[model samples]
Target: MHFCTKFLIVITAFCSYSMELKQPIVSYILNKINNSEEGTNSRADPLSKNVEGLEKLLSETEALNQTEKIYTVEHLVKSNGYPIETHYVTTGDGYILRVHRIPSSPKMNASNGKVAFLQHGILCSAADWVITGSEKGLGFLLADAGYDVWMGNARGNTWSRNHTTLNPDKDAKFWKFSFHEIGLYDIPAMIDYALEKTGASSVYYVGHSQGTTAYYVMLSELPAYNSKIKMAANLAPIAFLNHMSPLFQIMSLFEPMGNFLANLIGINEFMPTSNFFKYLIGNKICAEDSVTEYLCTNALFAFCGFDYAQLNKTLLLFIIKYTPAGGSTRQFFHYGQAIHSDKTNILSDLD
Candidate 1:
């Protein structure tokens, strides 16, 4: 090819790329607007800029939800559902996620607005709240304390594995949801259901790990749900990605590889070595027999016969059943920045 022709081709490509970038913004203002200049909650646009490092955290959160679980475990225990794993099929172009409701021991009055909704971390199921015989888990404790507690297993988790409109195993649309989508879509649905079931106007929210991240998305993307949230308690929450668990660091490198693996396995959230990965992750959490008993036991915090090793085993089994086959690569990176900063203030975006 002539040198001049080659140069012309390169110039054309560069110009085309620049134009493509500008087109979206121009289209948004001219075509995407509804004469309000308010593009889908302009209030959320700045996303509470004054809240410390939230703006930077949320911009990346939506991306991190796509990343996969780096570590895994081997379940020494087994998978046991309280009432049973329930599926809510929404007619959408994404995976059909599952939800699990943890059963509370007999006495639960909800304590008025004190009912709590427990959202598990990534690769976790509702069982995370009650792995062992101990009832001291946050979910169990809430229930024992006279608060109605309902644990949730999001769409990809083993429990919420069916969809009304998407096939995660075969359809490209099945993997369309990111953690952000959970906040924007699932939380509201869950909240509405919880409210109806409990006959309460509002309920306390307890989110651990990715569970908390999803709440941030809901709080940021759809501010309306914020009003429904009575009080939100974040346990080991990763609002600001800076101070995340060591387990999450590896996700940054693994994020790009997901697409290939999904294509290879014909899925998005499944861990190649799930059994092995579960044990690896189970070790990081509280696993001491004494700790599990004291921590997971009811309000009394009595010994519940759960050994540290058993806890690890239980935790592993829980992970295998819950972690979805496909994680959102884009959402994972979005949250990575927040993990790096370690700022819970990013949580204020929900306010």
Candidate 2:
């Protein structure tokens, strides 16, 4: 057989195997689409329609016997056969944040005290570092490379939803923070906690997307924090928003109105659970048999530029399950402020 012909044969067989394993999900999504069309009328309230759609999605997810549930950072780390530790660090503003650590791994032997810190993006948790599994995940890679790996969850995310005095649900003050607070408070606390625990003088920092944004804010605003890090590696660093996605542009336009309504209703958190978002983006688009899957995936790549070779279709469902974990409305507004500003700085004034 010709070389190109053999490659095509291998690709065809892999895709066929994937499709066979995903048949249950495809059938579930198809049934949900049909049921949604029949049960929901055009005049139905948007909220009601979304709730119905979310319930159906949840039901189908529960019915899938093959789907493994790994919801939290701890769950993800433990599943990969690595020893994990949970440490809670209290910020200067009294926010208690959860930080996950992989102190030592038997697979790789190196100095036990060398430290490396990993931070997640906006509306994401430490689980983001482990979602790709042990082979490819940066956390696992760092751990295997003999660095004491630590992953920090920002204040408003699912992992760090606690305060010393204020209740996150009842107290608006608990929700009244943005990346500025995260940079100045959360980052320092995590770094200090890791150093104190490991007895290390300086640690290496690695951040992705909003993680990189917060690091910039920290170093710029509090230049003294520069001493705590040995070196920094920024992945997909986002400093300015002069060129934003179409969806973000639309969001920027409505930000003022959204802020006003949030103030009027005393709502400081934006789409905490985001069931509507899950239903619309997670189910409607990522569904295995959906015709619009290509469009939805392309939409994700529109801003960053698509690389089909880098795409991993197999992890789509699990990715959706844990993402949009939660963030304060202030975080969204902060990004909006960045988009509108000419300067590459953290938005100082949220109100």
Candidate 3:
């Protein structure tokens, strides 16, 4: 399929799906996020004043929704009434990554159809594509639209935390990869696996944030893979660090120092958890009607341009629940290097 055509199909599906929702609720949420611009100010600490009350309210609300929590990608897909298949792809570096597939949906006859590979961003997992629920998420939407949808989980994430030889928990070598290894091994492994399973010559590639970064690297360094991809759709692509989020700007300044600290502390893995993540960011910042809701939401939009109208406050918890699914410290350090050097290529220590 043509790139523009595929994009339009996805957009049209999203619009049609959106129109089917209870507009009153959607409209109210949109209006609140849009009109309350003053609440999203970055200068103020959103959680500083009412910390105790916020924590209490969030705890109570979480207790109420305890039965509804979806943790793994398999649980997420099956809960949404979709048939999902789990495939394991072993990277060249021996890391075993999990890929999720939604072969068909009720809305379309997807047998023998074009395959669409969805890759998540940094510190994310396959669950990121489906966290927004069945009606809104791209994974479900693509499946319903008749595309054979496959979501990739990069190595070192929640889903891809295993290796053929080394144990992730004890082996320091397992965490020795940047996105460079992800591009060279993970992407190709998933691509080959998906194409072989579906008997397809080429597949459409859709990447977001760091997903796009790896795609660019793969196409640039190993051009042979170009023949295997039909079209590449990059969302919020991050090739240049000239313009960065304030949070990242501050982190960039401490890249070298942070790397030193990581080595000193012997911390290899970054924030990868279910319970802690839910309690921290999900409950504390995004629980329903929390005082600091705007702060957390705004930080996200500030880093990746705010689209108030599209901001659904209700889904914030789901977003938090699935994101920061964990990655190597080196992956983040690699981006930090890019930020300091202002170059896209991987930097050596001597550089």
In order of appearance, the predictions have TM-scores of 0.55, 0.77, 0.77
Superposed model 2: Cα runs more than 4 Å off: 1-69, 273-285, 292-309, 347-349
Candidate 3 C-alpha lDDT tens digits along 60-112: 65575564445678888998889899999998879999999999886675455
Q: List all candidate RMSDs to the true structure.
A: 21.1, 10.4, 10.9
lDDT of 1 by residue, 1-351 (tens): 223223333433343343343433222322322332344434231221344444444445445444434221112111222232343535234444455444353445335345678887665566667654335556555655767667676666655656776665666555555576677677767777778776888878989877888888888877888888899989776666554433345444454454456456655554322432233222221133322212121111111111334445344434433333335443454454334444454443210
Looking at candidate 2, what is the lDDT of residue 165? 99
List ranges where model 1 is wrong by over 4 Å. 1-97, 102-104, 107-113, 253-267, 272-351
Off by over 4 Å in 3: 1-69, 110-112, 298-308, 344-351
| Of 1 and 3, the candidate ranking higher by TM-score | 3
Candidate 2 residues 1-351, lDDT tens each? 223223333433333343344444334333444555566444322212455664675566556534434466788888899999999999998999999998877688665567999999887889888889999988998898889999999998888889999998899889888888899899999999999999999999999887988898888888888999899999877787766544455456777777778778987875464443354456655555454354344444433434558877667656766776788887877777666654365436465
